[model samples]
Target: MTSEVMIQSKFTKRFSKALMSLTLLSSLFSSTVHAHFQEIIPSSDIVESAEQRSLTLDLTFTHPMELGPVMDMAQPKVLDVITPEGRASLLGNLSLSSQSGEAKRYQASYQIKKPGDHIFYIEPAPYWEPSEGVMIVHHTKVVVDALNGKANWDALVGAPVEIEPLTRPYGLWTGNLFQGIVKKHGKPVPFAEVEVEWRNDGSVTVPFESYITQVFKADANGVFSYVMPKAGWWGFAALVEADEKMKNPEGNLVPVEEGGLIWVRTRDMK
Candidate 1:
């Protein structure tokens, strides 16, 4: 072949290979960069008499549905419980703890003093993610109903971002519709995006990346709904970019991703 033609052919081959590499790299990154959820999982969702009122809560930063590569969590900025009467700080009771293959998790125990729905919430300290070049802070919460109390299950705890449940946060059955309004700074965010996932307990397996989490968009009123497909704990995270920025570990200002998360449990009807 002519020199010019040979050179052109080689150039084309090199360019094609480079483009293929870029495409594969993009696909691999997209599959792994999933939604991180702040889990405020309790030992039990329902507290009966004072004997059963005490519950232990574990705070972990990770992908609950996938349950791997647990993100290191710093001490939370705020942790509190809101009852029918008022809100009280529970941070003093939190103790730094870790689990197998994970570090920097937290645990707390609280005793129910009255018949009311107790909402446990935490605003985790910002975590720097070098992969995304941003810091993430999730305002995560869960509810424990005491003696069938319905009060305070729907109360807002003034989180920077939060999911205000429209459906009763407890006593849900599988296939029941779960609805909540995505609020940021006490205002509705139109067309907010939410990620939903079920906490896996080693009985289930996901064959594809898409099966790890489900995404939905809120309506004009900042309300979204989903039906739980299984009998387990489900978490809904409404993510939004904060107006403020925080410095990352690299000492550079980066965008903050504020995730408003809430967890609820569903049981199958016999």
Candidate 2:
């Protein structure tokens, strides 16, 4: 073959190989499933002194482990704090957080006046996840201990689906085994599926895509447990399909992924 023809043939071969590699990488990444987590993280899980009485909560919808491609969060339909006293709406306190990208997030400030455990919860607007072909609704909550009063840490916020913490949900060190029962409509859901993820604050490097979200299931009576290996925020989401389907943006019926999420923090023993 002529030199020019030979060179052209070699270049074509190299180009074909590169194209194939790109296609393979794209397919591999597309197959990896990223778990969605609704975060309602508080500034302090426990308030001991007068200086710590005021607390701030950050609300966002995103892949907590992957950290991004944050989904836009609309104004929540309901935001409340439940305590032994009663449920009080905090929707008015929520304000838009200044974040990059078009996706919106929220924040709220609350003063811990009384001494008790306060469960702050949110019923976010349904998010349409086209990749999953479903609308996602995650009702998420976090507990804050006020003035050293730790009573009723397991109080339910009356979410559609909820996790009643078997553990205290706060004041813990790393490697602590956190346990909770998944409930739907105030009843235990036998053998429910739960996805857990650590809120990546750019500290821990994820080894693999699968490591981003840990998957496990609840046994009979819908109880689940996990020992957090890192000192940071961890979210447990128990997901179940609702009995009724909802219309998608295209006016087609799609399944609703109803999730009950709870957030807890672990600190390194000093």
Candidate 3:
């Protein structure tokens, strides 16, 4: 080969290696930095009339701010609704409803029979995150009030790791403050890290990566608080390393991220 052609071939090889390195770095940074939320969003937070008794909840595991890049979610180990009366399993109500090329999602249709707070919670199966090398299990919950029945909104679904809301968690103004206690096995977890994100509805623009997810730490008593400034569904996830490691898909032991998440919505007071 000519000397000029040899030089061009070497340059192209070097450029390709450099580009591959950049791509790998970018993927690693995104996987580790971006927040993952297990969402359980109800059709309505407050049910008033007869027509609104039927509620639909969309369940997915994804980056809430980015609104996409969803992860495949296996059927949850537990799915139930806790009310003033009692707790009832809703796993049979779940149906596969995933979009093309996206992760497996679930949609549940629930009929409100009584007047009270309906607390729906889920314990999703462990998702193996290859980028972070950890298994993620988020126990998520959302509350929907039926016919002005607001009792027992703070009821617990008895998760291994959970966020016990100090606030009512529903029917609030945009500027209202939300407080919750991070709990593990019904006990408080001091200084637990909590990540918060706003579910983008294709209207807001994220100016920077930092703006995508907001984070905070629980106090000495495992209590954290934040004020909602936007009128949409906000998800708060309290995350901590699990006491026990789980086997990965490769049959190797890996750390587990036990997260307790809760969802609430606010309005602009129109």
Candidate 4:
């Protein structure tokens, strides 16, 4: 063969080999990416009591990664409740709120009125790929008591509730700086609103301009805490605004006087 033809043949062989190597690398990378995308963690379920006699539903999702900033807002999770009669009730209409950091959790609550056995479940959807086929639904049974009466004024009031401070010594604001729990009638009231106000020394109380208020929902065990800001003599009170649409176990709207105040004091600020 001519030297010129030999050199051309060698160059062609080298070029073909390089192209094949690049193709193989691309395929391997595509497969790795696909595998990562397919991985998904299972979800969790929670059942809560909205009132002494009513039940609330909570559902949470576990994702493989941080779920990207955009999808974080979407908070894709499906929730449903099966009535005692075996009727499937869709939970999509309920308001969904999420908190994400070290852990991501979604919460929604609906009042269950009838005194019977009800099933709550988390249905799987396409936001995150589930390892199991179609994600088996996980659920819990909740019981409502028919004899419980509407929440009383004393049972809905709170006192001496210490809240966590907002600003740390380093001037960093931790999201849930509040850290204290309030209870009424020996049961933890989750997601109840607490208001704080600074009062003058005189019997006549002047509300401080820098008042703090927060709405906190209790955990599954009906417990919560809030950080108290710079501590001093401050009037604190716990209140749960009555929901006219919500009926107590006795089928009556929970009642509380509007603008009601349950006074207590926080002495030491830490």
**C-alpha lDDT score of every prediction, in listed order:** 0.90, 0.91, 0.93, 0.35
TM-score of 3: 0.98
> Tens-digit lDDT track for model 3 on 1-270?
999999999999999999999999999988899989999999899999988989988999999899778889999998999998889999999998886776799999999998999999999999999989999999999999899874888888899899998999988899999999999999999999999999999899899999999988999999999999999999999999999999999999999999999999999987
TM-score, prediction 1 = 0.88
Q: Residue 194 CA error for candidate 1 (Å)?
A: 0.3
Off by over 4 Å in 4: 1-51, 63-78, 99-105, 129-270
Better of 1 and 3 by TM-score: 3
Model 3: CA > 4 A from native: none
The TM-scores of all predictions, comma-separated, are 0.88, 0.89, 0.98, 0.26
Q: For this target, which candidate reaches the highest lDDT against the unseen true structure?
A: 3
lDDT tens readout by residue for model 4, 1-270:
999999999999999999999998886654323211111111211223444443344333321122212222233343444444444544554445454453344455555565433334343232322221121111112122223323111221122221221221111132324333445444456665554443323333324312222234555444444554433222233444332333333454444311112122233324
| RMSD of candidates 1 onward, in order | 4.6, 3.2, 1.0, 20.6
Instruction: Give me the overall lDDT of model 2.
Output: 0.91
Per-residue lDDT of 60-133 in model 1, one digit per residue for the tens?
Answer: 89888887658888899999999988899989999977966766899998988888899999999998877687
Q: If the candidates were sorted by their lDDT against the true structure, best first, what order would they fall in?
A: 3, 2, 1, 4
Which candidate order results from sorting by TM-score in descending order?
Answer: 3, 2, 1, 4
**Candidate that scores best on TM-score:** 3
Q: Worst lDDT window (10 residues) for model 3?
A: 148-157
Deviation of model 4 at 58, angstroms: 2.6
